[model samples]
Target: MRPRLLLVTDLGYPAAGRTYRDEDIDLAARLRADFAVAMCHPLDAAPLMAGFDLVLVRNSGPVLHYAEQYAEFRRVALESGTRVFSQLSGRADMAGKQYLLDLTAAGYPVIPTVDRVEDVGSLPDVPEYVVKPKLGADSVGLRFVPRAELGAVTGQLIQPRVPFRYEVSFYFVDHTFQYALHAPDPGRRWDLVPYEPTAADLAFAQRFVDWNTVDHGIQRVDACRTEDGDLLLVELEDLNPFLSLDRVPPGTRDAFVAALTAALLRMLA
Candidate 1:
């Protein structure tokens, strides 16, 4: 029998610069050729996971929208040993934005980030700083404040407003590099095109992928090119990362699907 797959997602989620439904629908159609697939909203994932061989969390929308439900799903999945793709061991976005602060403190190339008022003074003095809820995603709850106004907010993270040239995303499947896409215009974040990464670029992206705990599932390493041509980590998305597969060449897209299918088979085995 084909593996029974429970794909969790929210078709109606109003994600910025991306359509959650179209992507998930396209993925489900592809996976159907290899598995018995059923789809449901993230809120409903907890109860239904028991009946499936694997729970693939794709574009489930921000878990912040259903914190209680998401927490319950975690508890049940962990207690029941329900195999979840992008397993709960992820220390990045799957947990929260706290990883940014941790990476910054550890001297990683991430934009300097701090969550406490006491540490705000340590960051380089930029004219404007960014503040976002520690649990925020999709730029939700992100705000800008003058440098002098730092430490005035609580339960928020602070980072300098980077004057980066452009943003790029490196996609991976189980530590294997796939294709890349990037926004040439920094102002038009979603206006993306195919990007060809240099050997150095691949190494830079792979470093974080290596640092992450996921031995399965997709990962996207998002970064920005600073004015001085340095790359600073924007975010590490290990959970429900939007592949933007529609933007890649047909051959690359096919390769990604094959890799994903093999990963799932290995997982089930």
Candidate 2:
């Protein structure tokens, strides 16, 4: 019998610059050849996942829309040993944005982050700073403020707004780099094109994959190139990262599918 996979997603989710359903649709179709794949909305995942051999979440939209349901799904999956792609535990975006502040404190080359409003001084004295909630995703609830006004909010992070030239993302499967895509126009976040990553670029992205500790799952390390020609971490997305398969070449897309298929099989093994 084929492995029964429950693919969690929100078919009707309205993403800002991309189609959430289209990507998940392609992924579900690709995965169907290897497993008995069925797609469902994220809110129904907790109750429906019991019948599947594995639960693969892709483009499920932000958990902020259904935080309680997402919590319960995580709880049941962890307690029952229900295999979840990207796993139920990840230290990066999966566990809120706290890693940003932690990594900053550890002196990792990341956008300087401080959770407490008073600690805004630790960031560079830039004209503007970014303020966002720890649990925010998809730039939701994010605002730009002057450094002096950072203390107006509590329990949020402050970082100097970098004037990035372009943004690049490194995609990986099971710690192996798959392919990369970048936003050529800095203002257009999702207008992606295939990127050829240098060895040094791969090394920068690989560090976060090593830190995540999820042995078998997809991850995307997002970084931005500063005006000084340096790259700093933007986000490490370990949970249901939207792979821009449509942007990559057909061969690269096929490779990604093959890599993901093997990872899923290994996960169930």
Candidate 3:
């Protein structure tokens, strides 16, 4: 018999720049081929997760929206030995934005970031800086401020808003890259197109996927190409990253679904 999988998601939740419901619907349909799949909201996961052999969290949106419930789900899942995709073991988004600060400190090719007001000067001098909540996602509470206004926003850690040439994202399933996508227009982030990644680009994204150390799950390494032709890490999304399935070629999308299906099988095994 196929293993029962609890697919956790918020299908009705409206997200900016993308549709969360459509992704989950398509993914669930594909996953049902190999498992007895059931879908539920993020808030209901903690209570429902125990019934399934593995729980798959997909497109649930930022956990910050339901922090307490998410914490409860994590606590119960770990204690109960319930397998969760993008495993609770994730140290990136699962742990919050602190990883960005950690990467910055370690000189990773990331957007230089600081979390404390006093360290604002450590960032490169630029006309403007971007600031947002450490636990925020989907650009929630994100703001850009001018150099002169820096002092007023001193309490917030800042990063020089680099004028990146383009944004590219690397999608991986259990450390193996599936495909890539990019937004040619910086202002139109969700207007994605299939991206052909070079070996070097794969290596750059793989570094974080290796560091994340999840033995099973899906991850997206988001980065931007600097004006001088260098890629810097923007965010490592190990949580429910919205796969731009709508943007990729049909063959690429099919390959991704196959990868995800295999990963889930490994997790259950």
lDDT of 3 at 197: 97
lDDT of 3 by residue, 1-269 (tens): 88999888898888878998998898889888999999998999998888899999999988889999888998998899999998888889877888899899998999999977678778888988999888888888889988787777644457889999999999999999999999999999999999999999999999999999687988999999999999999999998999989898888889999998998888877
The C-alpha TM-scores of every prediction are 0.98, 0.98, 0.97
lDDT of 3 at 172: 96
Q: TM-score of the candidate numbered 2?
A: 0.98
Ranking by lDDT: 1, 2, 3
Q: List residue ranges in candidate 3 displaced over 4 A.
A: 154-156
- Candidate 2 regions off by >4 Å? none
Please report the TM-score between candidate 1 and the true structure.
Answer: 0.98
Best of the two (2, 3) by TM-score: 2
- How many clashes does the backbone of model 1 have? 0
Residue range with the least summed lDDT across 10 consecutive positions in model 2 = 115-124
Displacement of the residue 85 alpha carbon in candidate 1, Å: 0.5
> lDDT per residue, candidate 1, 70-171, as tens digits?
999999999999999988889999999989988998888999999887887888888999999888888889999998787587889989898999999999
